[model samples]
Target: MVHLRNRKNNYSGILIAISLVIMITVVSLVFKQIFLNRNNENEQNSVLYIQLLNKAMPVINGINYNDEVDTEENISIKGQLLKLIGIDIRNPFSVIGKEISMFTIGTEDSSENNKVVKRTLFKINPFDVNDKQINKSGQDTGDTENLELPNRNVKVNDPKLKEKLDNSKPQVLIYHTHTTESYSPYANYNTSHKKNVCSVGDSLAYNLETEYGISTIHDTTLHNAIFINSYHRSRVTVNKYLKKYKDFKLIIDIHRDGMPSGNVSALKERTTMKMNGENVAKMMFVLPKKNPHLSKNLAVSKKLEKISNKLFPGFCRGIDLHFNFGSVYFNQDLSNNALLIEVGSQYNSVKEADNTGKYLARIIAEYLHSKK
Candidate 1:
C-alpha cells in the first residue's frame, strides 16, 4: 500500500511539471508576439514606409499599379499592404485610402519649377448676388477702372499700326491659355453650346472677319489637357502662331473667370451687362507687366475699356494690370500687342460668353480702326 501511494504521488508531480512547462511556453509566445507587433509599427513609421507610401498612394487614388507585377516594388507593396491597411487580403476597399489620396494631392507643391503653389484659401472679395455694393450688372462698387501708366516713358500709340493691319492675312490672333475652361448650367461643359470658351473664340473670329473685315487667327490648342506645366506647353502653340503669322497685330489670350456660387458673400460673382435688352456677360482686360511694351499693352487695355464702356456701360471691368503676381510675362513679352481678356465667370452661360465675344470683336475692331 505504501509503494502504491508513492507511485500515485510521482504521477501527480509529473503532471504538475508538464502543466508548468506548457504555461511558460504560452507566456513566452505572447511576449514574443507583442514585441514583434511593436517592431512592425515602428517599421511602418520609418523613412522606408514614407517612400513606399508616396509610390503606393497613387495606386490607391486609382492610378494603375502596372509597374511590372513581378518586380520588387510589387512584392514590397504586397508585403506592406498591412501598413497601408491591416485587413484580410480578400477585402477590396478602404475609406482611409481615399482620404490619404485627397490629402496627398491637396498639398500645394508644384513639381514644375519647384515653386510653392499657393491658393487663396478664402475669397479675396466675398461675393453675394443681392449685395447693394454690387451693381445690378455685378460690378464691384470698389472695383474701379485703373488706366494709370506705370512710370514708363513709352506710350501705346503706334503710328504704323494702321498700315500693318491687313485683312488678306492673319492680323489678329486669339487663343485660350485655358482652352477647356467652360460654363455651368450647360450639360457636359465640353459639349454644351455657348458654354465652351472655344466656341466663343470661334464666334469672335467669325464676327471679326464678317462684320469688321478683320482677319483673325483662332488657335484652339487644348493647353490644360496636360495640367502640369500647361503654360509652358501653351507657349509652344503661341510661338508657332507668332512665327507663322508674322503680321499679327493683336494676340489675345481669352479666358473666363471663376467665382464661388450660391450666396457666398456680398460680391456679384457673375459679371453681366444689358445688350439689346438681353443680359450678357461683361468683359475684363488683364495687362501683364515686365514687358518692353508695358505702356503699349496698357494703352490697348484702356482702348478696349473705353470702347466696351461706351458700347455697353458697366460692360468693362476696366484693366486689371498684373504688376507683381503671376508670371511677369504672360506671352505678352513675345509680342508688343498682346491682350489677356477675361470675358466672364464660369457661372455665366456660354451664350453670355458668346455675346461678350461678339461685343469684344467690335471693341477690338474699333481699336484697330483707330490705329489705322
Candidate 2:
C-alpha cells in the first residue's frame, strides 16, 4: 500500500509540470501575435501618411504653353480619380488627345501670324473655324451642324480671303467710302476703317504683278459708292471687273480682319508651304457659299484646291461653306478664277503679313507653269 501511494504522487507531479509547460507556451504565442500585429499596423499607417504627404505637395512646372509658335504634343489620361488627385480639369478630351484642333475658332492668341503658327499642331483645324461670313441662303433648310468647340457665337472671318494686291504690278482701285473719322469710340482704339489703307492696298498689287508678271486692273469706281463691307464690295467689285476684263484668269479682292491681336482665328496658326523645295510663308485658300454667285466661287475654289493638292499635300487647310447668309454677287461672280485671301491681321507688322503675300505669288507662278 505505501509503494502504490508513492507512485501516485510521482504521477501527480509529472502532470502538474506538463500543464505548466503548456500554459507558458500558449502565453508566449499570444504575446508574439500581439507584438507582430502592432508592428504591421504602425508600418501601414506610416505608408499611408507618406502617400498623403506626397499628394498634397505642390507640383513643379517645366516649360509652358507658348503662344508664338506651337509644336505638336500629347498626354494621356485614363482615370477619373485623377481629378481628386489635382489633375487638370479643362478638357476631358485632351486626356485622350488635344481637344482643340489646329482650326478651333477663338483661340487665346488670335493674331494673324500667331494663328498660322498654331496650326502645325493638328496639321489642320478640326473645326471649320470660318472667319468669312457664311452664306446659308441657298440651303434647302434641312442642314444642321454640331460643333465640339468653343466660341461658337462670334462671327468667323475668312483668313484665306485676299486682303491686298501686293504691288503696282497688280494695280488696285480703292473705292472705299467707310473712312474712319478721328474718333476713339473705345479707349486706345483707332476706329478708322482705312487705317494703313494706302500701304496695304498699293503694296499688295505691286508685289503680285512685279513678282509674277500678272496685270491687275484697279477699278476705284464702284457705282460711286465709298462705304462698303466685304459683302457689298463683293457685289460692286466682282461685277465691274468681270465686265471689264474677260481674259483675266484671276480676280482677287483684298480685305483685312479686325480682332484682338490674339483672339482672331486667322493668325494663330503658322503654315509652311514647300515652294522651290523650301518651306516658305503659308497662305490659306477660301471659298464663299453665300455669294449671289455660287458657281463662280465653286469653280475658283475647285481650281485652287487642285493646284494646292498637287503643290501642297496638307497645305490647303480646307474650303469652308457658310450656310447662313447670302449675297447677290461677290467678285467671284466676275470670273471662275476669282479668289479671296486674308493676309496677316492688323496686329501683325506689314513685313510679317507681306511675307505671306510673297509666298502666294510663288505658288501662283508654279500653278500657272503646271497648267502650261
Candidate 3:
C-alpha cells in the first residue's frame, strides 16, 4: 500500500509540473506579443518602420494609415500572432513559393485611390539566347573600325502599298508590344504609362513626322502586365488599329532587351554603339521565319539594315529570325509590313536609346520614301 501511494504522488507531481510549464509558455508568449505591439506602435513613426512597411507592401504602402482599416496596426498584431504559433510572416517573398499555405491567404489592399494589386506577376523574360548574331561590331569586336554596308534595297514595289502610302491619314502605326521595357538610366520612371518604351516610340514618331513628312501614329497602350499573355493582348490593340485605320501601311513594334548582365550595368557588356563620340544603343530587326509573307518582311528589314549601317555604322545589329511561329507570331501574319525592333538592352541609358530613336526614324523615313 505504501509503495502504491508513493507512485501516485510522483505521477501527480509530474502532471502538476507539466501544467505549470504549459501555463508559463502561454503567458510568456502573450507578454512578448504585447511588448512587440507596443514597440511597433510607438516606433511606427520611425524611418526604419516606414521603409520596412514600404518594402513589405509596395503596392499600397504609400497610402496614409487609418485606424478604421488598421492596416499598420493589424500587420503588427497578425504578425505577432503568427510568430507565436511558430509562423514567420516577416519575409513574404521568401515563403511565397515554398509554402503551400500562403496560397490560402489573400493579400488585401484598402486604398482610397484604387491602388490595388490584383495579382503578383513575374516580369517577362526579355533575354533571348537563340538570337542569331551576324555582323557584330560595338565594343566586343577586336576590330575598332566604323561599320559600313552598301545600299542593299532590291526594291520590289507593291502597287497596293504605294496606293496606301499616299493616303492623308496616318500611314505608319508605331506601337510597343512590351511597352514597359525600360532603360537602366531611368529605371524609376513609371511603367504603367509614358517614360518607358512609349517614350522611344514618341521620339520615333516625332522624327518621322518632322523630318520626312510621314504621318505616323504612336499607340502608347500597355500590354505586358501579365507577361505570359503579352502577345495576345497586343494583337487586340493591333486589330483595333487595323480595323479603325484604312491607311495603315507599316506596323512597327518597339522593345528593349534585357541582358545576362544585370539590366543596369557599368560593364562593357551593355550593348551600345559609338556615334560621333556619344554612345548610342544598338537596334535589332526581327523577322518571322514561317510567315507566309516572309519574303516581303525580309525585304523591309534588309532595306532598314542597309540604310542603318551605311548612315550610322554599328547602329543596326543583324537581323534575327523567330523560328516558332506559335510562340511569337509578332502579328506579322496580320500585315506584311509589320516589323518588330528591339531598340537596346536595359543597360543602355535613356539618352543612348533616344539617339537610336532619332536614327531609326531617319532609316524608316528613307525606307518608306524609297518606295516612291
The local distance difference test score of model 2 is 0.40
- Model 3 alpha-carbon drift over 4 Å, by segment: 1-167, 186-194, 262-270, 326-328
Give TM-scores for every candidate, taking all chains together and pairing residue i with residue i. 0.54, 0.41, 0.54
lDDT of 1 by residue, 153-234 (tens): 2121223332333556887888877666676554222533245678789988887877667788888877755233445666
What do the candidate models score in CA lDDT, each in turn? 0.58, 0.40, 0.62
* C-alpha RMSD of each candidate structure in angstroms: 18.1, 27.4, 17.2
Q: Tens digits of per-residue lDDT for model 3 on 1-372?
A: 999999999999999999999879855765565455542222322323443456669986874432211321244545654655655575463354335432432233243332222233322233423225555444342221232322222221223222223335887898887676777544422374445778778888876766666788888887765333466778889899888884366899898765532112333233576665556678888765777878888888898899877776667877877354633467777887888888876666666677676678777777777876
Q: Rank candidates by TM-score, best first.
A: 1, 3, 2
lDDT of 2 by residue, 1-372 (tens): 999999999999999999999879654543343344442222222222333344446352322222101110121121222432433354443343334445332233234532322221223455554445677654423111111122212111223433333433332233221111111121111233333322334444555566555555644323212121334544555556545544355565544333333322233233323343333323454455655667766766676667656645545555545332323233455455666554433343433344444544545555554455
Candidate 1 Cα deviation (angstroms), residue 108: 28
